[model samples]
Target: MSKLQNVFFPLLAVVAAFIVGAIVIAAVGDDPLFVYGLFFSSVFGTIDGLSYTLFYATPLIFTGLAVALAFHCGLLNIGAEGQLQVAAFVCAWIGFTFNLPGLLLVPMCMLGAVLAGAIWAGIPGLLKARFGSHEVINTIMMNFIAAGITSYLTQYFYREPGDPILQTKHIYEQAHIARIAKLLSPLGVDLPQRLPLNLSLLIALAAAGGTYFFLWHTRWGYDLRAVGANPAAAQYGGVNVARNIVLAMCISGALAGMVAIGEVQGYRYRYYEGFSAGYGFTGIAVALLGRNHPLGIVLAALLFGALQRAGLFIDIFTDRVSKDLTVILQATIILFVGCEELFRQLKRRWAKPA
Candidate 1:
């Protein structure tokens, strides 16, 4: 496919998605214009709402990047959900238990989350590399394990004493995220001081650029891509396929871990049962929709984030449509994007030789 076609296809898919969404809205007797109006207001009507939406998008960027990175290496990292949970729990543990200055405490909590995520993802990688196990199976099962274990830890160990809910104690105030409205309090938002779009967003952006550089600009990245493209050929070319597989999973897991950074360090500043809400699963769609490009993943994450923000707004105004609309839209987009590679291949083959 030509470069123009490559770009055109995604735009077409988006237009199709909107048309479908409009049809659904009509069937439900909800006005699409009203839904869109609320969406616009929620996102841009007030600085506070926009702040929340972008803050929500921050962690998604990390998880999206995580899934995209693994997909590039031909690995199906179904474990991102579990990896993120473990990272969040670990970050909470460090945040609540450790007594350190703000500078050291913050970085330490982040480091702990990253390490936990790496370890969580590494388990499946090690299995796949050594035993030739299918990562799809191993990673999926690992996600369940991570969820169960993290829930148990949150309930038994991390749960804030005297609180009935399954949640951790608040992290030290020093570790709390800086809110944008609070930072610029003289210019107050109409609502309460909005949470700042955290440092994690910056970190996520950096990760994307860093991944792009590693994948397209570095020797190791070349080896990883070569292995992903064809393991037997890469092995023949002296790339250590086993080592690369493990490394890819580790890096992927680390990115997943950073998702917890946004949610825990920036948003909640604590861990809770069911805090993640299936970010890992959404990440798979993100990876496919992004064509596994780092920059593309950022865009995809924002799209999904916008849908989520809009979904909440839609729900507020209409009893007919639920937030599930956003999920359906996301699923539809993924289906189309997943088929895109096949379409591109067909186009390549159909083009006659000059």
Candidate 2:
């Protein structure tokens, strides 16, 4: 029943959100069916749309996993945005600074990104474990600090002289990763070279698989879950809560850091200051909508990815509807999902002794 409900309630929330979204579309003097059909058709009907949808989904998967991993340890990691940003810079830093071949340079960038994110996230974890300071507050503050530090570094050291953009020099060609279009073209598969979809999607899927195994099949995962479920009981059972807290945050940060693999090595080839369009923040919604499950996260990311892709068509084709409707729909979905928690709390209260 618990497992069924985990899936059922989320599905219910999505359905409810769409139903409400449909009403709103109609209220705004548009045909809800046309709007819905356009969104679904564009995202699913065309190869280009599908590619872009998956491309957008790639980063969301990384960020979603980051959030989910922390949730397992009873930690809310709202700092994935900052973590990814720092990691992206570090990854690009390695790529541009070192004149190594892809074999060495790629691994170095990945390691650097993972380590940088882990270190940044670990500070909050350390404080939380040592001082009982709230991870939320610490992580939130860390975001601003990360932003300031990264901004300073880019402006002072990384940015090429006379370059107006707040970005680093492009990584050398050796650090480049292959796009799906490039790989498939050799096999007579027709795909546009302009498509940003790349090998990072595979890495993201692997990360999701790795997360599932780590959380379900490993001892460390068990300890993390135990801590989350009942810290006192976990301590009684000889689990080191402090270590798990740090470990979870580090792992979460590592996953978040992987976002750079796609953005820098695979697509942009440099650290763009604003490359992320809230992928980290949107990850919280993905994690929630997915019920914090790895598989669910991927599916939810695809939904969001499709929504993102659909928005362009919505804005260009529709007369009364705007792309912001997607935001409204997402907010609606989140609200409905939140209501599930409310319902559970009410049920618990009602069942308690009067």
Candidate 3:
């Protein structure tokens, strides 16, 4: 598909999703306009809402990029959930165990997080490459294994003495990333401290740029993309498909691990059980809606983040409509995007300019 169509279909999907959502609301006898107005207002009108939206967007950005990168390599990585869980645990472990100064400790924790995720994901990658196993099945099974292993480690070794929460001991302050509010306060932005938004957002933005450059500007990335586009042709042209598969999964997992930077270092400051709110699965939808493109992924993540924030507001402030609308909308969006083939005819008449 051309760039314009790549962008257009997702936008059309989003519009179609909201239309379906509005219909559902109207079917339930609530004014669709009232519900949607309230929802969008809550997401955009208040600083708290916007800040929280961006905070939530941080992880989605990471996970979305992870999924998108895998897509670029013709790989389906459903293992981001497991990859992130393992990485978060490792990050917390490094944080508390090392207790080094910020200059040293923070980077060490980040490196640990990335390596943990890479190793976890690389297992499935290796299995696929060497044994001809399906990555989807391996990755899904790995999620369960990761959850059990992380839970055991936290319960037996990392949990604070007698703590009721299924979480590890807090990382030292030196490991914590300053919240965006604190960082901005020195420059007079003065955002409320309650907002969990942090430097991870900047990291996400940089990741997007880096992903774009890697996928479009580099020889290695070109080989990976060629493999994804046509593995048989890629091999005929001297690209090593197996190595790229493993390498792509490792890179994808590394991106997924960046989620720990936000969750462990920015907000919770610990490896908390159930910290993720289906970020891995939601990322699949984000990547689809973004057409597996980095810039588009960032935009899609923001939209989902805003929708997430609006869903919470609907739960709290509305009596007739519920947060389930957001779920319905998201599902509809995915369904619509999956039907992009329906746009093929139009694209013949509207091909993107070179």
Name the best candidate (by TM-score).
3
Looking at model 1, the pairs that clash are: 179-196, 180-196
Residues 36-61, model 1: lDDT tens digits: 67767887787667666777677777
lDDT of 1: 0.82
- When sorted by lDDT, best at the front, the candidate numbers are 2, 3, 1
Weakest lDDT window of 10 consecutive positions for candidate 3: 345-354
* Residue ranges of candidate 3 with Cα displaced over 4 Å: 343-354
Model 3's TM-score against the true structure: 0.95
The backbone clash count of each candidate, in order, is 2, 0, 0
TM per candidate: 0.91, 0.93, 0.95
Local accuracy of candidate 3 as per-residue lDDT tens digits, 1-354: 577777778998899899999899988878888888888898889999889899988899999999999999999999899999999999999998887899999999899999998999999999988998999999999999999999999999889999998999999999999899999998988788888999999999999999999999999899999989999999999999999999999999999999999999989999999999888888888899988889899999999998888998787777678988988888899898988776665666588753
Q: Rate the local accuracy (lDDT) of all candidates.
A: 0.82, 0.92, 0.91
Candidate 2 has a TM-score of 0.93
Best by lDDT: 2
For candidate 2, lDDT tens digit of each residue in 1-354? Answer: 499888888888899899999999999999999999999998999899999999999999999999999999999999999999999999999999999878998899989999998988898999999999999988888888888888899999999889999999899888888999999998999998999999999999999999999999999999999999899999999999999999999999999999999999999999989999888888888999999999999999999889888989999999998999988887788788878976577668999977
